[model samples]
Target: MEAYFIGLSFVLAAILYPLFIRMLKIKNIGQYIREEGPDLHNYKTGTPTAGGILFILISVLFGVILKVPLVFLLSLSLFGLIGFMDDVASIYKKDALGLKAWQKFLLQIIFAFGLVSLESTKPIFGVEVSRTLYNIFWIFVIVGASNAVNLTDGLDGLAGWVFITAILPFGFLKQDIFAIIVAAAVLSFLLYNTRPASIFMGDTGSLALGAFLATFAMHYNAEDALVFTSTIFIVETLSVIIQVSSFKLFNKRLFKMSPIHHHFELLGWKEEKIVGIFAGINLLIALTFIVYKMW
Candidate 1:
């Protein structure tokens, strides 16, 4: 029965992306690539943004059909709203910068704090902790994961495939029923989101995947193990932090570009090769986590 939803979502995503592309184009809702990004990506500017809406809608539809808990679906919708607003603002501004960093940060923190207060989220990897500390840590995971994915979205097929590698193993290993369902939908969306992507996932897709993956790991009481599962995201995020600090403190750029993927690209690695390598690294992390759990 669960597998049925997964298969259905995969088919739905495959059907929905092309249709969404046409609709978004008609509506003039498209992505605005950042000026600071690589010259190679300028061509992608104005591609249909909010392609994340495809998977988010699919997830909700399937969640209803599958009778997933209402609270979880609502929570997912809330996070998606935050991303949607950011996407909308960026389009209106005609630039990739949308929702000042502090604004996004505050919203994520509020959402994470509210989520952790839920009865089901009380347990953190089966360990008891003070509520204040737990809120801080959970906020870190939610915000960090969301932004990590946002940063990794610099290249075609990068964030989507990396998320698949990071997410599916834990879902299957832990028998997380909804994770499997969402994964199927995301996989189907990837049909159009790969190289020469017809549509960009934008912040909408990035935040949905990020918040969902972060919460999904917590849903299974495996937050501790998620560090291993999401190593690539963490590394990408850290590269940004390191670069920023270096520039601030010593006036030296740490990498040719931040997020590390851009650094590799600047070094002349093909986009396909970089995505493949990162996907490999993510697979290694997921496999290690699975083996650790089994052992």
Candidate 2:
């Protein structure tokens, strides 16, 4: 039954994406490129934005139909709402950057805190833990991962592929039903989100997906061992952090571009090649994580 649900969610996502594209009247809704971003991306202007909403809606509806816990449903919905707002803001501002830094952080903190409170007060997948520590740990995991994915969304299909990699190990663990459902929903989104994407996940998809993965990882208490499982997202976030810190402290650029993928792109690698190579690497890492953990 669970497997069936997973398969069904993916198929549904594949079908609904194009429909939503039309309904939202989002044709040629290009991303708001940062003035400082790579010169090549200037042409990406007028690509459709807010496509992430389709996947979010699909995932939530599927989860609800499967009767997932209210806590998880609420958490996912709240994060999706935040992403939706950010996406809308970006389109309105005509800037690639959506929410201001502080505004985003504030919202992330609020959602994370709310999710942590819910988890601490309830039994997650039948596992119990200290409420105080659980709440604190969840806040870090949720907010950190949510932003990590948001940062990784610079390239076509990069974040989506990385997310698929991260979710595989969790499915192998089979510790939480919600995790599997989320993973399935994400996979469905990836069908249209791959390289030369028909539609991008945008902030709406990335933020919600990140929050879902983070919350599920903590819920299953997979933190200590899932280090490799989340490597793609972590590396993406770290690359940006390192780049910013180096520039601020020593006026040095760490990578030609931050998030690592853009660095490769800047180095003259084709976008398709970079996506393929990184997706392969992410798969390898995820396989290793699963093998080691299950052994």
Report the number of the highest-lDDT candidate: 1
Which lDDT tens digits does candidate 1 get at residues 1-295? 7788888889888987888899999999988888888888889887888888888898888888878765457556767888888999999999899899899889988887776666353667677887777777777887788888888888888998888888888787877677788878888877888878888888888886888777776656678767887888889999999999999999999899988999999999999999999999999988987987888
Best by TM-score: 1
Clashes of each: 0, 5
- Over the full model, what C-alpha lDDT does candidate 1 score relative to the true structure? 0.83
Pairs with backbone N, CA or C atoms under 3 Å apart (clashes), candidate 1: none
Lowest lDDT sum, 10 consecutive residues, model 1, at 114-123
Instruction: Spell out the clash pairs found in candidate 2.
Output: 28-46, 29-47, 30-46, 30-47, 32-96
lDDT scores for all predictions?
0.83, 0.75
Worst 10 residues of 2 by lDDT: 118-127
Off by over 4 Å in 2: 25-30, 121-133, 175-177
lDDT by residue for model 2 (46-104), tens: 66666777767766787788787666676678887888888888888888778888988
How well does each candidate superpose onto the true structure, as a TM-score? Answer: 0.95, 0.90
